[model samples]
Target chain A: MPDDQLSRVFAALADPTRRDIVGRLAVGDATVGQLAAPYDVTVQAVSKHLRVLEDAGLVSRTRDAQRRPCHLEAEVFDLMTKWIERYQRQAEERYQRLDAVLARLQDDEQQQTDPDEGAAS
Target chain B: MPDDQLSRVFAALADPTRRDIVGRLAVGDATVGQLAAPYDVTVQAVSKHLRVLEDAGLVSRTRDAQRRPCHLEAEVFDLMTKWIERYQRQAEERYQRLDAVLARLQDDEQQQTDPDEGAAS
Candidate 1:
């Protein structure tokens, strides 16, 4: 539930062609035909991939006369970034704590192994 | 071609169980057995999930005597954030240009529809 948007974004990027589509759309808007021209896949297949990207909120379409141009929506990227950064920060904080605990444990072990080492020093 | 690390991270998060494991590890590090106890799936299944997360660089394990405890690696998240943000920024800049063109087209249409509207106003 928490990962709904991130899930969609991730799933959209899962396919290589869709990722390529995204890469192209990133540079500028393109019609389905224009976007599909570079690939061996049928226009229908490209359409399907665009549909997935659209559903994922990564792509948006607008009518340009007879052609429907797809535009990439960059704001949705923040959804994934927020999610990633949250967990990343959490994990790093956990790692820091783990390091502290490990250091304490090692110090305790040293104390046990060499009780007089501290006194000698 | 641009999505190598992003793919791994997305594919890793595609599994809910693994995402849950990540969430848990985010709060604190846990042993494999501890991570497995909450799920109905066998310890083996959870172990496999951990392996997936491990391969994706989302999770790391450290030996503690006979037991291996998994810790979340926050650094890897940057790889994905970078990718997502890059395309996102691209799309947004493209959008600005598209918007400018759209506004120009709208102005042209207005001029054509009411030829003397500009002169009258």
Candidate 2:
């Protein structure tokens, strides 16, 4: 529970139910009742989940006359994607560098262990 | 809060400090003391964060004699990326479909409203 939007966004999606609701909303916008129907949870429970999503700016509620529909803000996904990709790419690059360094070290060790092995063979 | 691996991963990364630690570990593995040196918090606090990351399988600590070094499990990043990509793609497709439908409806409306106007002009 960090206060930042990225933290909030990741925190909001930590729940399976909330993630499922997001999946359903991605297909189409739905009312809280409609979103809640598939789960065993109550409408209030689903509304609570929606509140978390809304707080994270991942979901927005629009007044459709008497009913309010929850719309998925897919653009927010870009924030999470960017964060994840930055670290993922950095980690992969580091791994590659580590691999190269290890390979060179292995070659150096071999050269030191048997300086004349190449000529003998 | 959820028991699933995806939930655990997202929940573990929800804290800013935890995410920062993950970023650092991504560059290379380090001892707990080494990891804690940069932060103002106690080593115990950093250990707690490491434990959360370890529980989520984003990191692993290997025993090298008495010292355990924390290594980033880069593969776990794939889970989060896949989940995010699936929903992001779905939502984008839905948005496109909605756009097409709206455009068609607008055209139909114009045709209905001015069926004779086009011919008259």
Candidate 3:
């Protein structure tokens, strides 16, 4: 119901059932009946899951006779990928910077003690 | 807490405030007070967000004197990226298969009409 696509996408995938449905759709499109066949839940419940996926733009549907086949829209995944990658890269860079700083400090400390330990070496 | 790491990670990121906190932490680690400076929320609320992030394995923390610095765990993003990519690739492959099938159907139709249309050509 919200316009925040990122949040919607994450929330849409928070449930295992929804994730499973997405997986099945990825292999091929299916009507709600077909998607619900393997689940113990009612068709109405499966329909609700489809609605959530549809709202998140992770899925789309088209009318074919009386059936509305749900299709996976892989392009929607780019949004999540970009967001996750941006943060992941930043975090990794920060960790690398910290490591570099620690290495520099160790080098500085070694230099400071080099003259004192010259005879020992 | 649920043992579902993927769900927890997704649920943690479902909130805009939490996502913003993650984005900030990605750039560098920060204390709760420092992290709370940019947001209108209280330090307690920010702490709660941090706890959720910690539970989701998206963040880690260390005690330094009286301060606890929160660090972003970028490796957790791989879980999400892998899940999203799996479905995206499957969907793309399915689309390609469908296209190939359609192309073959067209070729078969063309072959059937070739014998009759020979004089017209």
- On lDDT, who's better, 1 or 3? 3
List model 3 lDDT by residue over B1-121, tens digit each.
3469999998899889899999999888899999999989899999999999999999999999999999898898999999999988888888889999999999998998888689678
Q: Model 3 segments beyond 4 Å from truth?
A: A116-121, B114-121
Q: How close is each model in CA RMSD to the real structure?
A: 4.0, 2.7, 2.7
TM-scores for the candidates: 0.78, 0.93, 0.92
lDDT of 2 by residue, B4-89 (tens): 99999999988999899999988889999999999999999999999999999999999988778999998998999999999999
What's the C-alpha lDDT at position B11 in model 3?
85
Span of 10 residues, lowest total lDDT, candidate 1 chain B: B1-10
Off by over 4 Å in 2: A116-121, B116-121
- For candidate 3 chain A, which ten residues in a row score worst on lDDT? A1-10
Model 2 C-alpha lDDT per residue in residues A1-121, reported as the tens digit of each score: 5789999999999999989999999999999888988999788998899999999999999998878899999999999989999889999999899999999999999987686776677
Q: Tens digits of per-residue lDDT for model 1 on A1-121?
A: 2347667777787677888899998998899999999999899999999988898898999998989999888778787777777888887777789799999999999878796776778
Query: Which of 1 and 2 is ahead in lDDT?
Result: 2
Q: In model 1, which regions exceed 4 Å deviation?
A: A1-3, A63-66, A99-115, A118-121, B1-3, B64-66, B99-115, B118-121
Which pairs clash (backbone N, Cα, C closer than 3 Å) in model 3?
A: none
